[model samples]
Target: MSETTSFGDWLRPALPLLLLRLLIDEPGHGYGLVEKLRAAGISARGTTVYPHLSKLQDAGYITSHWQTPETGPA
Candidate 1:
């Protein structure tokens, strides 16, 4: 992004909302979420995304469960 931080300055405030909207449209695990953000050119790194997701979950804005992939370790 234009900034030196993990995520862009423009997206800092709205990151949580964007993440919620993405989950609402299509639920995914952490890596997938990171991929989606990268696909959209949001410049979100795991270090940035995971903490937000955790906060969202902690605040009851979202929830998650473990799901093993067919070809990968859980």
Candidate 2:
């Protein structure tokens, strides 16, 4: 095991609530969510954020869908 605890561990308990707050006004993708958290002075990674997103989705707190860019190859 690593001796150092990641920033995620420290924030894990409150992460879901924080994430929900961020999404309340608008929908956002994973990377965007991480960026928003960082802008708010919280540091997190996909490993930290995505699992909570899954939990929220499982509990029906949020939903998601893939959006293809109009100009991108599909």
Task: Write candidate 2's Cα lDDT for 1-74 as tens digits.
Answer: 76997775779899999999999999998889999999999988888899999999999999989898899663
Local lDDT at 9 for model 1: 63
lDDT of 1: 0.85
TM, every model:
0.80, 0.81
Q: What's model 1's TM-score? A: 0.80
lDDT of 1 by residue, 1-74 (tens): 47375446668788898799889987777778889988998878888889999999999999988887899688
Model 2 clash tally? Answer: 0
True-structure Cα RMSD, model 1: 4.3
Task: After superposing candidate 2 on the true structure, give the runs of residues whose Cα lies further than 4 Å from its correct spot.
Answer: 1-10
